[model samples]
Target: MNVYMKEQEIKTKLSAWVAGQSSGYHADSVPFDLRIIEQRIITSVQIMELILFLEHLRGEPINPMQIKPGAFSTINSIYQHFFIEGQAYA
Candidate 1:
């Protein structure tokens, strides 16, 4: 596959893994509007955790400074961090 396609695949896989991890903590009674708030918090935490996990998988140390603001604004952004930007886990 092309580099971009491969990156997209990685992003999708990472997003799914992150979502699955966060899903376990989700509340069933959260209203739809409040769901956005919950998701934002969870997404932020998940992104950080996912980065750590990726770093671990790649046998590297976590670099908190490298995680830019808005880096995890969207799932696509997280993918870009790893594949397009070559940030990997560390």
Candidate 2:
């Protein structure tokens, strides 16, 4: 897939996962730029789960050093970090 399509696919998966975190939210309701961590849409305990999910999407293990603060802060950030920057799945 091309970059935009891949990015969109990643966003959709991320949105679906994030939306599953709580009630009153749907995949379409989760904004790409939403602050998932600060807003507590994803709690601290679930952050690890999110990372694992991301790794699953990438089809490989993520490097520990690549993880940084705010990397999982939003769907956009996560996509940029793992898909664009990491380029592992691509």
Which prediction has the highest lDDT against the true structure? 2
How far off is residue 66 in model 2, in Å? Answer: 3.3
Once fitted onto the true fold, the runs of candidate 1 whose alpha carbons sit more than 4 angstroms away are 24-38, 41-45, 56-59, 87-90
Q: Please list the residue runs of candidate 2 whose C-alpha ends up more than 4 Å from where it truly belongs after superposition.
A: 87-90
TM-score of each: 0.57, 0.88
For residues 1-90, what per-residue lDDT tens digits would candidate 2 score against the true structure?
Answer: 987898898899999999998787987889999998888889988887887898899888886565767788899998888887876433
Q: Candidate 1 at 67: error in angstroms?
A: 1.6
lDDT of 1: 0.55
User: How does each model score on lDDT?
Assistant: 0.55, 0.84
Q: How displaced is residue 22 in candidate 2, in Å? A: 1.4
Per-residue alpha-carbon lDDT of candidate 1 for residues 1-90, written as tens digits (9 for 90 to 100):
987777655655555555566554333322222333235645556656777766754456757677666555555665556545744436
Q: What lDDT is reached at residue 20 by model 2? A: 93
| Candidate 2, position 53, lDDT | 90
Cα TM-score of candidate 2: 0.88
